[model samples]
Target: MADLEDEPQAATVAVGSLDDVAPPPRQPPSEPADPAAGSLERARELLAAHPIADGGSGLALALREAPLYDIEDGERLLETDIPRLRDGGVGAQFWSLHVRGELTGDRAVTATLDQLDLVRSLVADFAEGLRLAMSAGDMADARNCGRIAVLLGPVAGPALGDSLATLRAYHALGVRSVTISGTRWTQRTGLTPFGQEVIREMNRLGVLVDLSGCTLETMRSTLVAAKAPVVISHHPEPVPDDVLRQLRANRGVCMVACTGASIRETADRLDHVRETAGPQSVALTGAYDTGSPHAPGLADVSCFPRLIAELLDRDWPQPDIETLTWTNVSRMLRDAEFVSRAMQARRPASTARPTPLDA
Candidate 1:
């Protein structure tokens, strides 16, 4: 994940019900007509046809701090809302379940559960616009129904409390993705035997093993161990070109985090990722509501189309853009599901625990 070093401190505010929230804010004025209007319109048309299936979002983490933050109305206090999501042409989103690094053991598990509850409640509250998606098919169904598919994932591996049982429980509760390393575990030399077991269990359960903040050793270890395709939800700076090539061989996806300070820079980063890692391995994620600074014109969820327009202006082929926005991530999910079924048929879930020696 991009550094949240500049994350704005959450204000102390009272919680309120969705009904008490104000009506949706007025839409901002459209940009003045320009020579690029044709590209912008084409971009919108392309997105309308193949809306983005964003690989990661931190809305749940933001909402954890401000429970009353409503998305129905254009909640300026936060980065995401229904109207903005619709405006952004986001058809699916992976809501990251992240807790502070200091949290561990039962505390971490409980905090993660709270984040899950918050996300589930938000989905329930906004059922008309959001639908929980536990599978690739569900995501496609939600998109067809004109609802944003909400996929849940834990951004920190510690949230599992080093227990496969807890991990299974989370899967049962609808977590489709789990980061293999977090702040505490990222420094490890490589995956321990137990860590390898966790990877196996996650594969059997069809959960995406996210290697966002993992060390190179850990990432390589996971790539070797995982039967299902893994995902890097955010751009990890430490990852070199070789790792990307390895990722391509592993049939994984790098959901490039668009953390650039400007739309053009973001497009450049995407292009670079596509070139380094094969086009099939590239995907897009805004990291919205993660408390990270966003580039101008890409400051909120509504700005995805603007970025797409920039890509169009760069003469990127519509097919490539379609692959970036929807195809790659969706295929990764479907591949994971396919691998999971085969793995489950071969072996039952392993009963494994980490030992001090393993650590």
Candidate 2:
């Protein structure tokens, strides 16, 4: 994989005036066909064959605020509900287990555990609609059974309290993904030596690395160091084109957030990422209940079909759409699991401790 120094900068676009352009001859106006009719149907058909595997969400945080909020009820709470998830064709969702950034040490770890418990409780309470998934196979099985798979992921590295043993403990508790940066701990230094160890441990445990808020430097370093594929979950800003290109070599996926002024804008962002990095490296995240405003048409999780229809109208290939909705994330998880099995067989769990430099 190319390092940050070697990656090319994004090309700039220049605008030109149309002062010298001439107008074409006018022709008779004709009635336009309703393009949405055919495209919407096609989008739904594609979704039935391959449902969405959302990269991340903040519904758990919302539940933390209103413990009484019941997802089983037909009423929508924030951006998700049982009915809306079904309407949206979401087969698998990674509910972010995020705590306040101010909380640290034992307090952070404990709060994260509480968030995990809350997610598990929600899945158990709504057993008919939700199923806890720990592996890629589990996600597929959930979809096959008509239940939404719930995968757990911490929003930042601080949730681990700087302990690899705690990392293992969380994995035992069914945490499948961890964001290695994006917190105050590593904001200044990027990925420290200790962060590298965390990535290796995550690889050994089959936990997915999420570079949601890392700097480009950190992302490039992690890409070169990681053994398995990584993910950038729920990034609102456009991922730099250079990073998208680097993903081609690392086999990582950049999940486009569903937060724009309109569904059309969201589709345009997806188009840009797909064009930059092949369709195999692009995916979607509803980014629901993260306290961010969702797009007008994509106000809730039920609006995913609208975006898909837009893509279909733009003539996106069926296979490429399928890869965006499901194949990429599923393949990434399976690859992580494959790497874990091999690493575990070759070596033991890392016992290295953080040094003063890592701080």
Candidate 3:
């Protein structure tokens, strides 16, 4: 994710009812005159026509994307975006809380809290269209209820303020994963010793480890520490062979972000990954952001079907596509959730608060 300005401290917070908080107004539906509507609609149509996984299997999931609302810019999801996602056949989104480099110490934690509040407010206001999901089952429930499952993901573990308990608090608060340092906005190259400890704690806590912008050493060390499958939500170009080998051993999924590249280039990368890591190890991700300019033939979430359609046009096997689109990530989430439950059971009574959404 690209760096952005830090969110200012909230003067007052409303954690009560949805009636007390108001989200940014939704953007109007896309019309034919709109710049990207025609292509988006075509992709949506193709997505609906193709049933993902067939035989009533679960829906496809994306690993990373920015939140729908931009508090700094007063921008919100366009009215067409939800339909675009549904049409694109996206069942769940790990809406990322990208911590800017400027935020540090207490400010970082405050910023994370603010983003969490913002997403919760949006979900509450748009309950008909969205659900706050903490686990794979919750995501499936949202899909069954005809809504998008929104999971919390914090990028840059510095937001946890150098505390393992703080990390557990984040887990209790429903954060499913954390990216350990190295975001686009930061000059921070490698994980600190404390950062490594956080990874070990995350494994014990059943929280997913995210290696999005980490250094090669960071990825290597974290992969070794993590007991559960970690996710490289967005891979940088020139992916390392050793990292691929580690991921193959860890059973991790490398989500290929669909931006700034052609379908063929993306396909070639996935093919290369398969050749190196074997099948069911690579997945597709839009890393979609309403704020950024659209990638050709892949603009918003709605462009997903177009990707699948193009892959099919290339004669990619349907089963492999199914693994890339759905199963691998789903299985990873389930594995993490199981570990989380076991950890929660072993936790002390002093930590006996209800999980987020339950609280």
Candidate 4:
């Protein structure tokens, strides 16, 4: 995949005096709508009708960009936006704390912390509907309690600079996953000697390594180095067999992104990967969020059920579908927490940070 280049600017609309143009006669009927939308709607209906068969237990999850911070002007989460996710059958979401690559050193760290504060405030403001979930168990608990479990992830490793301790520190502060690079390469791109150290540290800390926007080389190197399962939080393109084989060998999952271009062919690619790599290797993510840099297509969080529906239409088995929607992601997260907890148990009390569960 190419480094995410500067997106071509949106086409500007020209404004002119309406009085200068004459009124048209009758308009022709609109063309037949694509079946995708209707199929997606049917999927939503299925989710609503069935309710995941476990009360949102093992229900859908979305790797959404940070909604609270990225909201358009005059938008509010509690009053207006979050309900859409609720309506979309989203049981959990990984809200990103994206620090741009340009913000190096303390600026990046400070910005990440500020976003953390923003996320915390969101949980507080929407207490009944949201909860801060730092582990897989916490996520399940939040779902069981009928609240959407909100988890923290930061896009790009620049927020950590050159500090391995900073990665651990973020884990202590409830960051469960992190993207190693963004549109640009991070300080440690996993292709360098120091980058390997970063990957190993992330594995040791049980922080899920995300290889979303990194270079192919970075993805390969990181896969080799990471002891824990990794995820491509937003895979905007298809991978060759070698990459799929490597991901399978490393027990990683790629959250197939749902942008305009990515969405159209996602199912076909997903099928090919499943056939080549196995069912455990793929999951779903909607990176073309309201704040997505990609051109608009999939509208919002609501597009998820539609995606599920699309797969269903193709006769994907329910079990395989669950693996695509939930099980793959759930397993990765649960394993990360298991490793973390085991490590914490072995560590001396002086070295271990106090976890919420222990409290």
Per-model CA lDDT versus the true structure: 0.85, 0.87, 0.64, 0.65
* Model 3: per-residue Cα lDDT over 153-221, one tens digit each: 744567866566777788888888787654221224444445555565687676788787777777887
Better model by lDDT: candidate 1 vs candidate 4: 1
Over all chains combined, what TM-score does candidate 1 have?
Answer: 0.88
| Clash count, candidate 2 | 0
- Stretches off by above 4 angstroms in model 4 are 1-42, 45-80, 182-190, 261-263, 288-290, 293-297, 342-359
Quote the positional error of residue 352 for candidate 3 in Å: 20
- Candidate 4: worst-modelled 10 consecutive residues by lDDT: 53-62
Write one digit per residue (lDDT tens) for candidate 1, span 1-359: 25685787686546877676668989999988785778788888999989999988989988888888878887799889999999999999999997877888789889999999989998998999999999989999999999999999854788888788988999999999998776343446878777888888999999999998888888888888888888988855735788788888888988877676788888887887788888888888889988777887798898898889998888888899998998888899899999989999998988887777455
What is candidate 4's lDDT per residue for 1-359, written digit by digit as tens?
24445666676546888776667898899999878777777677655533221111101111123343422222333212456666667777777777555787789888788777767776787778878887778877887888877777744577875566777788888887777774233323335555665665676677898877677777888778777788877655676678788989877886665655544476776788888768898876655332444223445565567667768779888778777766677788887767666765664322222233211
Report the lDDT tens digits of candidate 2 across residue range 1-359. 56986988886545566754556989989979778977777777888889999888898988899888768875665788988898888999999997887888788888899999989988998999999999999999999899999999954688777788988999999999898775443545467788888889999999999888888788888888899999998765778998899887788899999887888888898999999989989999988888878878889888888899999888899899999999999999999999999999997999877888776
Q: Model 1, which residues run further than 4 Å from truth?
A: 1-33, 183-187, 236-238
Model 2 residue 44 lDDT score: 79
lDDT of 1: 0.85
Full-model lDDT, candidate 3: 0.64
lDDT of 2 at 262: 89
Instruction: Candidate 4: give the clashing pairs.
Output: 40-306
Off by over 4 Å in 2: 1-33, 183-189
Q: Each model's number of backbone clashes?
A: 0, 0, 0, 1
TM-score of 4: 0.72
- Clashes by residue pair, model 3: none
